[model samples]
Target: MLNIKNLYASVQGNQILKGVSLAVNAGEVHAIMGPNGSGKSTLSRVVTGHPQYTVDGGVLEYDIGGQMTNIIGKEPDERAREGIFLAFQYPVEIPGVPASEFLRASYNAVGRHHGLEEMDPIDFDVFVREKMKVLEMDDKYLDRALNVDFSGGEKKRNEILQMAVLNPRLALLDETDSGLDIDSMKIVAHGVNTLRSKRNAMIVITHYQRLLNFIKPDFVHILYQGKIIKSGGPDLALKVEDKGYDWLIK
Candidate 1:
């Protein structure tokens, strides 16, 4: 559903992603593993049309209604409306906005884009509660300011909750496993796995393989020096876990 070709990107005039390429089809889960500074997070930002990162060269395309269209110049909201979702490594806190209010606004915006009717607060509460169930979240989360004082695990689960509500066709999870304990990671992974379907795809970016153990990627890739240098099956992650990136880098 997504295809990238030799993408070259830079942030603040310093190049980060150099000649990186990958293709992800519908229903597939791909895990990207690399050490720090390997451009793992940069790839996700570039794909999501982050304003700070400029794409200097190559093509970035996505299947918009079954046709691969170049999305380099598209605005971030435009890309989001096209079913691209990014789960940030560090979810920002919105001090005054209730989480439910924020979620409903986003859900309604995406729904309106697809010619669907918006739900009233009462109706949306019912709708979002079901999604919250998938993440095992309580109703209290709805009243809190978005991530205002949430713990690391709570923030991560909230991100998955957003993903469930938006139901994006292409989900880019940037370091979802970061700052999460094993139990918390498992819970977050359960929420992610529940959302997996034939009509959607996920690109999981991380520095370790433990996250893969729960998410169970269909493919594993080693990203190094801003390029995907190795690709293999699930065993590739096992190898990385056993030997680390040093072996792959060498």
Candidate 2:
């Protein structure tokens, strides 16, 4: 579970997130929808301890296994090791690293942090191949360099694959639907849906409601001008899709 209160954040010298407060509990999915420059992505980065965003004031806390811990000063890797996952809006390519090698290294690193046994190559291949079935991914992808020359859909599916493998406690998806075709969107959504469980929470940040059609959120939030202005149920997304943020912003 995560709790944020009156959070303010800035990049460089300009303030972005102003007085943003939200709570997410286990077994719930929250969708954050907003127009351009509304600090939607900033909120996700701030939560995951992105170095560029500074927490100017207020509280950002995470209750990991019944203990309330403040993440204000935590490093990004620290937060990630603590079970926080952020799927970037635009995944970057690591030109030389093969996807399989990268995934195995990442999985083993996280495993060591959580005191879980590391998987050997054979075991990891079987493990990852099984999870690949959820996303309909083929083994050919594993042999390619990470995200290099991958289509938009392939990159998005790759992010979902990473998520499925990590199985974090809280997942923040920043525009996972962007630039994805219908088939790709469904594949990504299916991977997310398959990963959903009562013990994990998801915060989906999107501009349109179409992605929500695939992954139903328990709560829908409208974030505008660096703060969350309105919060409602799934119907809220439909309203935004129909009337635009103008109806809610005004």
lDDT of 1 by residue, 1-250 (tens): 9999999999999898889989999999999999899999999999999999999999899999789999998999889988999999999999999998899999999889999999899998998898888787877999999999999889999999999989999999999999998988988999999999999999999888899989999999999998999999999999988988887777
What's the count of clashing pairs in each model shown? 0, 0
RMSD of 1: 0.9
Q: Show the colliding residue pairs in model 1.
A: none
RMSD of every prediction: 0.9, 0.9
Report the C-alpha lDDT of model 2 over 1-250, residue by residue, as the tens digit. Answer: 8999999999998899999999999989999999999999999999999898899998999986689889899999888888899998999899999999999998988899989999999999999999998898877999999999998888989999999999999999999999998988988998999989999999999999999999999999999999999999999999999999998777
lDDT of 2: 0.94
Please list the C-alpha lDDT of all candidates, in the order they appear.
Answer: 0.93, 0.94
Task: Give candidate 1 misplaced runs (Cα > 4 Å).
Answer: none
Which candidate has the top score in lDDT? 2
